[model samples]
Target: MSESEQLMVVDSTGQPLYPATRKKIHQEGLWHETFHCFVINHEEGHVILQQRAKQKKDFPGLIDITAAGHLLAGETPRDGIRELEEEIGLVRQFEQLFPLGVFLEELILGDLKDRERVHLFLTDESMPLERYVLQTEEVSRLIALPFSEFARLTDETAETFQTADQEIIHRDQFVPHPSAYFRRVNEGIQAYRVQQT
Candidate 1:
C-alpha cells in the first residue's frame, strides 16, 4: 500500500489494536488510537458537537465528539490531547479533563476499515463558540444542543436529527451511538440542575 493508504486491523471482538509502530498488525484488521472530548458548556446548558468535514475518510458530515484524532506511532495518549488542541483550538491539559475511560471498538468507514482504541474525556470549558478556529479540512461546522432538548430528542420517536447549519443534512453516524452517551450524560446534567433549582 502507498504511504497514504493506512492499514487497519481488528481483534476478535473487532476492536482496534494499536501497535508500537506505524506498520500494519499481524492480525486481521487495523489499529488506531482516537481521542474524544465531550465538552460541556455548563453555563449555557449545552454540549458542543462538531460536524466532521465531508472530506474525512469516514463518517464525514456526521455529528461527532467535540474533538478527536488518531494517535501517531510512538506517541502516548498525551499526544492525542495535543491533536485535540490542534484540530479544534481548545487549549487545556490532560489533567483538567475527566477521563471517561476507553471505548474499544471496530467500525467500517466507507471502504476503509477503522478499529480504534478511543479514549474519552469530558470537560467544562467556557469559550465563545464563534472564536473556535475550525480546521476546515477536519471540521465543517459546530453546533450546541440544549441540554434538555438534546435529552428530549433521544426520547422522541425520531432516532436522528438534521445537523445544525444548512438545516437539511440529517446525521446517521452510529458507532458509539449519540443517544447512548447522551442519555448517560443527561442524567448528570439533570441532577446538577435539580440541585441548583
Candidate 2:
C-alpha cells in the first residue's frame, strides 16, 4: 500500500505514533487528527473536488473535498499543509489558507471505525487542476464545481458524482454536503462572508 493507503495513528491531540503500531493504536484511540482542505476558486466561485480511487480502503470511488490527510505525530495542522504538497504537489504557505476551525466527527463505515478531530481550512485560490500531480492510486480524477451548485446538489438526491472516466465517484456516499464535514465548510464560508463585510 502507498502512503495514502497506510493508516496513521495519533494521540487525541493529533500526535503521530510509531509506524509499526499505528494500526493497533488507532483502534485503541490513543490519538486522532485529520486535516481537510476546501480548495476554492474564488475567481470562478467554484471548489475543487477529487474523486477517490476505487481501491481506497474506505469510501472508495467517492467524490470528496479537495484534499485531506491525517496529521502525523508531533505535527501541527500547518504540517498537514505540507502533507498536501506531498500528496498532490501543492506548495504554499500557511497565510494563503483561512482557518475554518475544527470539529469532532465519528462514524462507522462497514468494518472500519473512524474517530477524527478534523481540522478544516479554506483557500479561495488554489493551483490549477492541470498543474496538480495526483497520487493516481489514491485519486482517480478531479473536478471544479461551482460552490453554489455543490450546495444545490447537497439539497438534491443524487447518489454521487462520477468522474469523466468513471474511475472515480464524486457523489454523497463518500462525502456529503449536509454532513458534519460540509457543515463546517458552510461555517467557514459564512465566517468568510462576514469578514468580507
Best model per lDDT? 2
Candidate 2, residues 64-172, lDDT tens digits: the string is: 8778887665667887787457656677788888998777777655554667778888876646778888888878877876665555454446555433234334354
**Which ranges in model 2 have alpha carbons more than 4 Å from their true place?**
1-20, 25-31, 153-173, 176-178, 193-197
TM-score of each: 0.71, 0.76
Tens-place lDDT digits, model 1, residues 54-156? 9875566777778876655555567678756776788889887766666765555445455566676777776867888888888887787667556755563
TM-score of 2: 0.76
Best by TM-score: 2
Evaluate all candidate structures by whole-model CA lDDT and list the values in order: 0.63, 0.67
- Candidate 2 lDDT score relative to the true structure: 0.67
Over 4 Å off, model 1:
1-28, 152-157, 160-197
